[model samples]
Target: MAGTFYRVQCADCENEQVVFGKASTTVSCAVCGTTLARPTGGNASIEHEIVETVESR
Candidate 1:
């Protein structure tokens, strides 16, 4: 399966992970052995930009 790299911190375990693509639905924290949050797929990248319009009175 295709996957991507992610860096996340465990809520219960408070451990940081550098997941490399195709992460499991439930991953155990290596430090405190806590369940981590997993992606539900269908996620897309988001970008934002601002445009300014000037008017003279």
Candidate 2:
């Protein structure tokens, strides 16, 4: 199956960004530079609020 993606809202700046569910590296907020997601070797550890889930086809 295709990997999933998540729309996360930054807690500090409320910036909405699309992040891979299995991101290999750390993901930061686009506007605020806050840590939004962290690599966990599997699904990324989301640090902010999850706005939506994106499915790959």
| Candidate 1 C-alpha error for residue 43, in Å | 8.1
Instruction: Give me the overall lDDT of model 1.
Output: 0.47
**Residue pairs with backbone atoms closer than 3 Å in model 2 (clashes):** none
Query: lDDT of each structure?
Result: 0.47, 0.89
What are the runs in model 1 whose C-alpha is more than 4 Å off?
37-57
TM-score of each: 0.45, 0.90
* lDDT for position 47 in model 1: 16
For model 2 the local lDDT of residue 28 reads: 91
**In candidate 2, what are the lDDT values of residues 1-57, reduced to their tens digit?**
568989999888888999998899999987989999899988889999999987664
**Model 1 lDDT tens row, 17-53:** 6554344455556888765544456432211111221
49 Cα displacement, candidate 1 (Å) = 24
Q: State how far residue 8 of model 2 sits from its true place (Å).
A: 0.3
Worst 10 residues of 1 by lDDT: 44-53
Q: In candidate 2, how many Å is residue 6 off? A: 0.6
